[model samples]
Target: MSSAGVGCLYGVGVGPGDPELLTLKAVRVLKAAPIIFTPQATGSKDSLALMVARNYVDESRQRLIYASFVMGGTSDGVWSEAAERIAGYLLGGEDVAFLTQGDPLLYGSFMYVMVKVQAAHPTIPIEVVPGVTSITASASRAKMPLVSHGERLAVLPAMYGIDDLRDVLARNDTVVLMKVNRRAMAAVSQLEADGELSRCVFVRRATTPREQIAFSLREIAPEDIDYFSMLILSGKKGQV
Candidate 1:
């Protein structure tokens, strides 16, 4: 396709599970784009990102593209494939928007696709729109302050293991743990051992229909944890 016919690409963050949390710029871009792309997990019925963005996008006027991207899988092929599919639309001069569940740069699959697409088509224009992250949403839903003045904040993925979790907990005034699915109990155990369980708050699927908020880790069952769950540990306690 000719360079003149190529369209711009937008990486839009739909926000943490809430459609209303979507930024105005994100909605504007979604409305203007001719095509929308969202990532779906393998064997999933629908894309969560797309579900969050459905209210803003005009489905009848825009074409939807669902790309399969498995979580915790060690492979770059899926990202490359998704990029190529999006490139096809861009080559035809159709502006494309790729929706992500949270901030596109924070533990999101959009970064992988963005890198691949940009590497292959350096000249194509691209933009990234930030959104409300799960950390902030969880804090808000739990009615807790993530940090106060002069407090250090550290965000870590639970997959990094318990040792790192302990270290961060000791040093940071506020620690946000993300992707704590199967590791929920392990994380809880560590916090309990350190005498920090009382300061911990757990939130699952924040701001969504399935949302669950726990003031204490003990209040949540291991089976209740989901991939979208997050844990917040503050050195000081807040109203629960």
Candidate 2:
């Protein structure tokens, strides 16, 4: 990774919510990179990962590039427009670091960028730096382990349909459900009916100042949970 070798792309993970949980390597790459790109949903007012990185970034030097948008173009053409802007920086030979809230490759917006960049510039070297995901953070906070002897762990984004959710729960011993929001209540309820809810732990805004942990989903206030939450369910007793 020479400075002049077209300046590689780094998908650096900042960890789930906690700025301090960022790996030393992630920090080093972030600070050294001349261009730091953070993802923001097309209409979002603020970028959470960027806000967390701001706590460590040297404001005087590093240039901030807001790579705003989701994979699908918005009605206002904001998403495609934002992608083009980010592509411009990468094509300009800048060592760009695409920062994400959790491990960059794990359900992070970095995947969208990586795919776009690869299609546009096949020779570009993209590096991925792993960071602790929300599941691990939630587990640590709740003193729960996602894995135990003979226990299989499956991670599913709450975006799954009811059938899919039920199927996964029936198959896996331990499951970590992400992107939990109001829409996920039905699936959560199903988990209870399956006799797995009591073994579940819910962490909302894990690792941040607003962090909340609930041993049972029933204990969580309906108005409190949003997409930022994660649910960790353990299997049988003695599995941990």
Candidate 3:
């Protein structure tokens, strides 16, 4: 729990889709926070991060704040507005926690809010608690090693065009493609063209109830994948 005199801001990663995967520190801070903020995608009723951490949240004691973040667009204004709302709580000397899925620093929207909050309130105490990333979770559930001794691993978002993905596939021993929603088939096609589809495994919503794994690209249709889907590509074939 934070001290009484000054309020603190905590950026907490609730881990990837699994409540049990949350760190002890994340639980502690979330419990202690008087106000909790979770990012809700525009048009979404609930935030995924909040859902992952709901078991640890005491709604009666903690005030829940939902901040709207528009996905796949310029979110500077959204982040700024969220920061402003959090700034008000900090000024009132209330400890606030912002919950995010996966690690706060890794492709999480919390980073955007963090920067803006820091810029607005430089003296406010802030801490970031790290959690298990989806990449590692997907790899673990698939029973595949992301990289071996001397093997290089590359992590990329599928939005980085097919040409760039092809170049990286040519250079790296292992690659993890994240944010693979509608682009799943395109990625599968690219891997197949490179003769690497056999070594690729597709995982969706790792560690969650809706978790799905496809060892062969043929088993995965683009329509079946969600925004949380990821593909782990290995240089060797028949690994899965």
Candidate 4:
């Protein structure tokens, strides 16, 4: 994509908290981009995506921007503000690479920024460097393949009611529940009711130094669940 008098906006995925899991393309972009934007919670100072790519960034030569967002919905205004802030740098002809924890298009904060920026600046150069997502990482950590040949898969947030998740489970061969931290116990109860407890496993921060795993869902308590954790349920026997 060619654009006159504007810098490119890159949606870069750093991948599930593991520095080593970062793709060569992600590292290349991080190093080459003059402006790097990371997302953080309103009151938080850390961004997992930035932490994952910190080694590749030269602080003295690059400018780092943190776009804060309210975790659960209600972040529209903030997204717009962030887009404007990024646009300032783009207008100055500095390439901006916004870092996301996983694939930018999949549940990443970058997705929100991407939409706003694209809507506001239709002619701006935009590129996305996809990286590993927690869904597949959780599956691999548990030795569970998300799907085989013809199997269908569904990825849903556990924060929603079980009735919603149950409906998806009924149709898909593999069900991946993201954000299982908030509803860990509820999810376990629903899985038990559906006779799917044994087929599920919990994986936290897959491939990271602080990664945690539980082959049995009951072993983990909702209170102890991490925000980055997930539950991967494979309907049939296919684990290693």
Per-model C-alpha lDDT, please?
Answer: 0.83, 0.76, 0.84, 0.80
Each prediction's TM-score versus the true structure: 0.90, 0.85, 0.91, 0.91
For model 1, the superposed segments whose C-alpha errors exceed 4 Å read 1-4, 159-161, 235-240
lDDT tens per residue, model 4, 81-149: 999999888888889999998899999888888899999888788999998998887777778878789
Candidate 1: lDDT over CA atoms?
A: 0.83
TM-score between model 4 and native: 0.91
TM-score of 2: 0.85
Residue 140 of model 1, lDDT score: 93
**Candidate 2, residue 76: how far the Cα is off, in Å:** 13
Question: How many residue pairs of model 4 clash at the backbone?
Answer: 0
In candidate 3, what are the lDDT values of residues 46-135, reduced to their tens digit?
899999999989998899999887765678888899999998888788989999999999998889988988887788888999989999
Highest-scoring model, lDDT: 3
- Where in model 3 is the C-alpha error above 4 Å? 1-4, 236-240
Which stretches in model 4 have alpha-carbon errors above 4 Å?
1-3, 235-240
Worst 10-residue lDDT window for candidate 4 reads 231-240
Give me candidate 3's TM-score against the actual structure.
0.91
